[model samples]
Target: MNHPMVVGIDGSAHSSAAADWAAREAALRGVPLHLVHASPPLPGNAVPPPAADRLRHLGEQMLARTVADLGDRHPHLEMRGEQSDDSPATALLAAARTAGLLVVGTRGTGGFDALAVGSVALRMAMAAPCPVVLVPRQPAGAFGDGVPAARDVTQVVVGFDAHHPVSETADFAFSAAEARGAGLRVVMAWALPAESVSPRTPAVTEEDRATWEDQEVAQLSDALRAWREKYPRVTIRPDVVLLHPAEALLNASRGAQLLVVGRRTDPQAVDGRLGFVAHGVLHHARCPVAVVPHVD
Candidate 1:
């Protein structure tokens, strides 16, 4: 449809906010906004009876209302609305295949619980055809009486694993930073082994603690040096603590607007297993996370 942004809309207030945001983004980018509402189909074995007919009618009404409401606010925008019989996640992905960006609400009116990322949002983010923006549900009257400010900066805080290539992540992170006119922070977290700490020793000698700390900082410096040019404005931060990388990132994200991580490139042994660190952060990080698939 040549839309710059494709946004999924349900009846939730969060969805309305997302539509508003998408409409503004489209206007800024000088492109059309495509609105989609997907409805799951009835069982294939079921007959096309009165109940099935009623369900279809309801779906149409919902789509119509959503389009009308959003269109009212953005009368100058070129908006296209559609209702289709497909799972919400699948349908949105299909519609976004040709879009420049996809915007989704963190929660929806669907039966799924809204603690973390909604299922559809997560699925689309993991395998979307383009970049996806996950917007949280703001409090009542948050976007009242005026349009909120546009996000001029897109903070991409990347967690680089020691064994992984920092250059790949840094490349993409810099692109995002430059595109949004934001500064990038390249972070390296070092996990101290339990063996390093002694139960009997109350105060360790300065020489001993300094030895371990130096090694950790040196490793982080080497990584930063390799990608120094890509992000000249990048801030290098190192953490040497007794915590898992995933847990450390979750806490570090308090100051970040977006968290960036690379897709696992670990070779699955005969058993075929993925890296636990990537899985952990993806499912639990408080802020929206961007998983950059391996560069071919």
Candidate 2:
């Protein structure tokens, strides 16, 4: 079965932007688009059947309008929408299982602006079976230039940790870059090793700092070598930052069309986890963010 690109809708500006982005992606990938809205089941049978029917009607109406609007925006693109009776996370996870990619908004109707990533979005980001992209409230980061209408870029930014590299993530980013005919910006953020900071070690000299920086640059190159060979046409930009991983990547994400990060999958665990860097970028980046799952 061919998996379609999926987006979660909640009638919010952010979700609307996400839906629009998903439509563009679906068109780019030449795949169908699926829009899903999850509504919690009403409390016990106390509510009359008509009341329940009205709620369902409202959801269906929203779905219909979204489908119609995007269909008009993307004429040849195949699209469909559905209203499901389940919590948002549950419905999204089910959709992700068969989706080529999943997209969500930074904040939904029920999300708190103070919170970077909402519960549902974060949950799906960490647990979705496929890549999850969190698009911001405003529609930005679409690449390409030229009036009347411009196209999104083939450019993508990805973060890597040299000590704990994940090939799945590297390949995913490369595949996306390759698919888009864009360049890949790879980032690896690091700090002086613990031993370098110990009291036993004298204050690091400029020479030492330079040496460490060189090592970091080498590490990034080595980590991305295979991917470079695999995608010779992808212009690779290697950056090594001496700052927090999250801070470094988030900084690099500026002006990038899409940012990709990795989330470890724990088969024995029920909860999801993301490093500070992934967590930071997901909630704060200006462009759309993609979280890929990896098993250690």
Q: Tens digits of per-residue lDDT for model 1 on 23-82?
A: 776765668888888777678858577777787778789778877776787788888888
Worst 10 residues of 1 by lDDT: 265-274
**Residue-level lDDT for 133 in candidate 1:** 67
TM-score of each: 0.66, 0.90
Instruction: Give per-residue lDDT, candidate 2, residue 218.
Output: 85
Q: Which candidate is the best by lDDT?
A: 2
Q: Write the per-residue lDDT of candidate 2 for residues 1-296, one digit (tens) a residue.
A: 15799999989888999999999888888899999998777889977889888888888899899999999999999998988898888999989889989999978888566876688888888788888999987545532332221323456889987777898788878877877888888898888877886677768878989999998888877877777888898888888988888888877776677889999889888767887778878867878899998889
Stretches > 4 Å off in candidate 2? 45-48, 139-154, 200-202
lDDT at 146, model 2: 22
Best by TM-score: 2
